[model samples]
Target: MSATGAIPVPPGKAGKAGKERFDAAGRRVLLVCVAGGFTTLIDQSVLNTSIPALRESLHAQPAHLQWIVAGYSLAFGLALIPGGRLGDVRGRKWFFVGGLALFTVVSLLSATATEPWALVVSRLLQGAGAGLVNSQMIGTLQDVFQGQLRARALGMYAVTGGLAFALGPPVGGAVLAAVGPEYGWRLTFLLNVPFGLATLWLAARHLPRPRPSARDADLDLVGLLLVGALTLALMLPFVQPPGWAGWLGFAVAAALLLGALAWWQRRFARAGGHPLIHPALTRSAPYALGTAVAMAQFGSSLAAGLVLAMFLQDGLGLSPLGAALVALPSAVAMGFASAVAWRVVARFGRRTVTAGMTGSALTMLTGGLVALWAPAGPLPWLLALLQLLGGASIGLMGASNQAFVLRHAPAEAAGVSGAILQMAQRIAAAVSISALSGVYLRATGGGGGHRAAFAWASGVCAAVAALAVLASVLAGRATAREEAAREESALAVTSNEPARESTRASG
Candidate 1:
């Protein structure tokens, strides 16, 4: 290892075994880092099955319920960019350890909260910590692996995330059924503490601290506030039914904040100051379009899960355990698909994402039809089939979209790029869930009838899938162009190197 803390690869055949050993070490570090991400996703999904329990126990209003869920997501999304940028400047390991510590403490707080409002605050803090931890994970991966190893590591990361999300409902349901709702849901939060501590130990032992680059800039405090306010303004109306006045106030404030953020970023860039995210990175066609596609996929996928859960529990009168069992096929399929995603991407490149989105759209449309007309006796079977398709779609798209967006990103900017990608995803999940919940509640009128609501949510999922298809296609084109340009540039440099060396020798 270099004095700067970078792992130097040995040259030629003599160093081959050393390189292999280094690669193995990197994989271990990746697993440790991904554990944090897995835990975060579990935290998000485990709460789903427990929502009814929370309402009954806490006497929570609909608004309170929404906040309890959306609060975590909003804080997570809001903090990611700044968190990632902060990691870039101050060291990801430091930020990661601090974030894990905070998350563990808040998990305990969430488990102990007796009031709905108290739980909401705890969830927000927990998500803030999750954001900080997650912001650094991909950067850590980028730091350790290269070439084909990097691709496989990223695919594994995606697989872990998918499994965590898929496992949450079943795990949460089992707990709720086994221990009873009052205490079981609380145990879900408490479960993170030990896992977090173990992961922290591994990270401290395994993670390398590379020297920070000169380009690492100060944390954009003003930009952070602007983004936080912007996200809040945009997301608030979804969670709480804002009246006309409230909507107007939020809209005006959102516009003003957005404009202010843009102005500040441009001014900072012109002054040779680093913004939270470099303006160029945002403008890059492949990255921007890939981010949109990822957002759409995440939104639709999360909403679909919620709607399916409702369909099973309410529309068909299944117990939470039964519902979880019926949903298991999707998770299984997702795991299978994730395992092979890298191979598919290697051969087909961005077309894999386009194909995945297309499949997702078809699945949602099919699911919606089934929800509208299929008999309850056949509902479980049909939903399983649909989930199989949906899970496969998500598994195929998740890692590919992430890798595509960051493929052209500068090494130093990996943290910020990853932060933006994940922030968009979490934002999409929170907003879509809020909108779908509103639709479900309004459609059912707080009753057992949820067919109409399920169909509506399915339609929205279909629309999101369609958007993803468009974005993925455009992203594919942009990615191909970018790759080709990069190839040509590399050839130019390679072709000139020999000539330059020959000239020097003659001189």
Candidate 2:
């Protein structure tokens, strides 16, 4: 590493023709990564509209229904960090290919399931596969691109995810309408097969194989178990809340587990072991604050989206298709905004994140007011407009902020860094959904109706949005200080260069 903190480029690595060839190859690889992400993220939300059709077909019990939907997310979260670390130690190529293959095979398995229990198991495995693949995708981007080029690649990635999420409901609903109810939901799982296979083939051909590891990875069994248990402890209360006492117990367990994990990681490091997470990552102010930004944006945005879907269907009594159509404008706006976000980040840096957070907060507030005050005929249109603005804010924030956070990661630990960033978001998503939906559920049960429920939940989202903005500001300042320090050091070195030259001349 140089005094300026940049790793020096290798000799013969900067030739123009060679660089161009590498760039072209890297772009092809990027397309494969994005395609894989697009497939998995679509799976994340596609089942939302498939529940009714699913229940009717499988005659699934209430518990089965809950597991089918929530299990996927739970498994996805559980797989991220460990998978990322493993991909770092082992080559990413096999993991990416294996994970995608597993995902595809299981999608077919899910499509063939006659029993809900079988479907639940398959979905959980599928989520794990998706998690594995997704982590590699982020890590691969970090490995492949740098500087403004990285920002652009990640921007494309973030926007693709946003579009996948926004498209999930309508795509699922359209499938249901096209086919009869019985087979529609099954077919939804099958959608992944073709896409996954094509992407898998491309990945096998294009993904660069990094040099082999000198030694086998030291799989930290104890640390991995602790993290896994901690994730479950945190997620369960949100998914299957078992009264206030139970919730308190889980929270305490999570806290205790966190402390234990931290202690173990320190011990493991002192023993000269490669811990699952990099030690430097935990100490980073930039990482912590950037994580805060991602968590808030992901959690509140997803919860808000869920609330809108429920409000349209359960509250305003719109058809599934109708609700999806109303929500489509947000996706459209998000796609457009994300495509341009890297340019904004280039000009504005981290302030772009603050702007996005502020915009999100205001939009959430506006959405609440619209829910409470708009007439029935105009409610959907008005909410759609609100979502359009919200989507743009979210899109700009997601890509730029992701690039912002990952920028702080040490290259050697890039995989785990990306994993942890997303892992934080997943945990936040669980928490936000619990808090906001808990409020919504209580309000509706109290006969306050959908308007009151939405209004109260939106208030919670706005608070999270505020937190995101504050974090963004702090992160920006931290990054600025680091950059300023580097500049000063460089100037000091430059100032002594002439004196050194004069002494050499005299000698």
Candidate 3:
């Protein structure tokens, strides 16, 4: 057994046998991870659709109800880094199976939940399990596939996840409607049991048992605590009553926690110990910049969708079903666009990213203008068109951005690199949602507010689009530099090899 707990085969049979075993393990891991993702999607989507039912049944206030949703996100976001590190240290297959088991049990408990708090706790546990599953997925992929094959597999993984996000709500709604309110919400949680069990069984039977490498480092418990604290502090304002005091407290707490985390990581690096995120990779311009762009893009996209849903239901007085129908265009566009994203990236290189971001910016600007100027006017199909355009742009840019980041990252830092990106995205989403929600509430005059909330949301969308454009420009420059460097390095190697061979012949 290797220090990392990976089983070492005899040299003669190692190459061929390892390849065969890895191939089998990859499929099983992928199945289980994807199944977990589906359940997470179902949990989020079903809750959103059944919120009204839940409120009526439990007599819950808006604040309490929001917690039901926010609890899951909070847990999921906070656990990501720790979970990824656990996979790195303890071996992925076990963590993957354990995560699924936890998810399944909690899901069953959630279905039987009688009160809001009970469901909220269950959702938190489910989210933690989801975090474990997601964090290890890409690491498993890396372990199983290599080079171009890896890229293709990762692309497919992204596509599957995008489709799940797009389809979740509609599927949840359909199931809920069919079963009625009494059984609908319960069905959402219970739906995972069969798939989870199947994944667990497959994993147990077919997954390779990775030898635990004693060389694996201990978990950075302090770093994990700080990260969890920082995340919670950042998200607190969103869940609590909005006030200067609440916001100020959250900000201070977040700043302290983040500052401590940074210090701890630096200390660990100086001591030659492995940190949760490697300092070298974290400090690299490509990783840092790519992570920033990803954060802003993901944050803005999620905020826009949530705000749009609110506008459709509260501002326009549309039914939940009507709002969902209106939002379908963007979801459909995202799903289809992601499949062809790799082709677009290859053809245009970084220019494609710039163009996509430009398109997104224009769409957001147009949507904002329409919202502000034609508040009560004719329902322009422009909203749908703009959404489609924005979705496609995001789909194209996101896939390429991920590839570029991973391509530049050092091999040993893969798990940390992935975790950093994921963390940025989660933090961005949480902040954007809170900020945008506040803006919407202020613009419209609270829960029973005005149509102006839509206008404000439109403005926020436009700002995000502008940021996307800037990110595209910066990312393009970085990609060009990277490509040029690669070419120069190849040329140098080619030139040196011939000279060395000639010297040897002469001698």
The most accurate candidate by lDDT is 2
RMSD of each: 5.6, 4.6, 6.8
Q: List the residue pairs that clash in candidate 1.
A: none
Candidate 2 root-mean-square deviation in Å? 4.6
State the lDDT of candidate 2 residue by residue for 147-230, as single tens digits: 656656776787788889878877876777788568888889999989999999999999988545666667677887887788
TM-score of each: 0.87, 0.86, 0.84
What candidate 1 gets wrong by more than 4 Å, as runs, is 1-24, 209-217, 244-249, 410-412, 446-448, 483-507
lDDT of 1 by residue, 378-463 (tens): 88888888888888888887877787777756555554677777888888877777777666655775664688778888998899
How do all the candidates rank in terms of lDDT, highest first? 2, 1, 3
Tens-digit lDDT string for candidate 3 (384-415): 67777877877777767777666667767765
TM-score-best of 1 and 2: 1
Q: Which candidate is the best by TM-score?
A: 1
- Tell me the lDDT of candidate 3: 0.68
Candidates' C-alpha lDDT: 0.78, 0.79, 0.68
Instruction: List the lowest-lDDT window of 10 residues for candidate 3.
Output: 1-10
Residue-level lDDT for 452 in candidate 3: 57
Native-vs-model 1 lDDT?
0.78
Model 2, residue 33: distance off in Å is 1.3
Report the lDDT of model 1 for residue 155. 64
Order by TM-score, highest first: 1, 2, 3
